[model samples]
Target: MTSTPPHQSVLDKPFVLDLFAGPGGLDVAGHRLGIPSLGIEWDKQACLTRYAAGLETLHADVSAVRRDSFESLPPEINVLAGGPPCQTYSVAGRGAGRQALEDVKGYIKRLMAGESDAEIDKKLMRLSDPRTALVLEPLRYAIQATRSPNRGHRPYDVIVLEQVPAVEALWERYAEVLQDTGLPDGTKYNVVVDVLKTETYGVPQTRSRAVLIARREGLGDAPSLPDPTHRAYEAKEWNRRNGGIAAAPVTQQTLYDVDAPEPRRRPTEDARLEHWTSMGDALAEPVGIKHRGRKAPFLVRSNYGSSGIPGRRGVRTDRQPATTVTGRISRFVVFEHLGHDVVCEGPRFSMNEAGMLQSFPPDYPWSGTAQAQQVGNAVPPLFGAHLLSAALGLPAPAAEAMREPWVPAAEEQRAKLRSHGCGAADGCTARCPRPV
Candidate 1:
């Protein structure tokens, strides 16, 4: 019989309003760190998943949520966080640049106008209007109304936003609009967390995302991106257990195959071998091309070319960690490859496994179809917890003791550096250091 895993939250004990809160990736992350977070998502299925995981969630359009709606609940909201949809500005879709920002601003402007403002309310009610514009409306409303010196209330202490790298530049506008709302002119609001990832934090899959952390000036410093607890890049003195400045690199092997459940043995070795071989060939050769030598594995499976190879030739793979997981895609069929070659393909990752790769707790219950699982699309819970913790000026949870592969190489290098007496206490040089 299999043993159940222990239960513990990932982030601080409580935060406010998981905006754009699809399937509560942010909420799960906050929970993992012991942080309490409420979620607001339009999708009912997504909200159900959050509710199942013990989160306070609202199934409603975020834009339509009014500051007045929660006025009776509490006077303080610790954090405001979410990743608004990015397809409007994603590379794959139409690059809806500044216009998208304008639409978002318009939404907030509409929300800020009271119901008494019949003209503005009518325009906001237009069904043809883009709802994405309303995504940030509540934030803008809270920002404007909450800033009066004696208003007897405070908005969220910190505003945390996440999106694709392409949206990095838009933060400037986000900051500007936020400031226009109630924040003081000099309010040091807006911190761009450039490097956030599940893989870097030991989630196995390397999912990169940018998180924007902003807070009122007097409320302490803006959230700092958590130091990588686990290294995805190899460094000479980085140790997994030792808490220090130097971090170690995470390996691909550690991310993919580690902690995975045993695969279902096919009826015959020939079948299994053939499956492995085919996947091996795909990994060896870039996707889209047939290899001559190795008999491609016997796995007869359908393949979909999602990420187009540049050359449309030889094997390829993406060196950087993969984009967010859509879930439901077969594992053996490589959606992303190195250049054109498939990497490792065997069985489709289980929902729980994908969630782990995305940094969700092993037992976090996620409701919905594989497409709606939100495993890959959501931010890793660990990374989210760290960011939320930093925003709230709370201490990070103690990291679990785990074996790290890079430790050996790092130790070997550290030993050589120690003899020279040139190594810092942690043996890390700000820039890449070469031993003399």
Candidate 2:
């Protein structure tokens, strides 16, 4: 279990419960922003990861959770958050077919009704209660919930949803639900759907996530959306939407382009440049394998570019924001090392990097194999710190490096290396053999 810090007091102490909380990404963010959280996940490794992050977690299937049991806890649980498994709604998953939709619908019904049958109670936990406000994610579940017979009839005070562009239709449904369940006179609601990237908020990777926040009547003028504080762009079309005297558009350069006076175009041979351009590579330490076939299953293409795989040199750029980092790096972005123009034939984003880009603290522990650790995961606490800080009208606290054995030894080693005039290639340009 991760040890809690001494002499450090949590900020607001808003009690939160995370359902399907993978490695406590959301919980970490909440805590960094002053809210205390508990996580519920069935995967033992994921549960351990969350526990290591100093969160109290329940290692049980979400379907088996007893609402009556949670309701039994004090009413201090101000926020309830979770993303039901996305595979059901995933564009690639069972095609969101009738069976898939019905299965999820059944879950939503249990979520809102707080009712549990013998069969479902044996497998899942329900979240449909008034005391513990719900903040559902991925947009798909939220949209479906709004359309059910329980429309506008929910117990929570706020509903925040997020997803990819392909799921925007879900947001429209959320909007309609809000209209149908018109708020009481004094209650207010906000529906924000836009492209928000991790880099703009200080994460190193260039990941754009579409966020939708719906405020119930009581949560104080739905937390104001965090305004963009930084900027960069990919090409002319990248900023076609932002004209009139804007700063540089948020691009790969914003995070990686340090010390360079202007945006520099790197030729294909510069592996370092390619790594920086590839969000996945930037977060990953190369695995010493040449491009053979597809490396990971979750391969994503954002744009078009040239390739060098014999006759298969196809150019694809990842302009669109990535789907969730499912801990499967191969599922996020593509990579190419064929000495020709680099092609992202595999997923480029790693779950770890994506989590960091999502504001997870640098030290948050990830579970499962390396691939699972990289893609399918949580937005780091660091990312949540920015958003939560804004919501609570407080300054984000400085991150305290964890003093675990795994980390301190690395710090000591780096210090030793620094004394000998030897450091990683990225740092020691003059003294080291390779500069880059």
Assess each prediction's global lDDT (C-alpha) against the native.
Answer: 0.47, 0.41
Instruction: Give the per-residue lDDT digits (tens) of candidate 2, residues 260-323.
Output: 2323443533332221223332234322122222222122332222232322322122322243
Off by over 4 Å in 1: 1-14, 97-99, 102-129, 144-151, 177-198, 230-323, 327-345, 370-373, 397-436
TM-score of 1: 0.59
**Estimated TM-score for each candidate:** 0.59, 0.53
Model 1: lowest-lDDT 10 consecutive positions: 400-409
**Model 1 clashes, total count:** 51
Off by over 4 Å in 2: 1-13, 66-68, 91-94, 97-155, 178-191, 232-261, 264-326, 330-359, 368-375, 390-436
> Model 1's lDDT to the true fold?
0.47
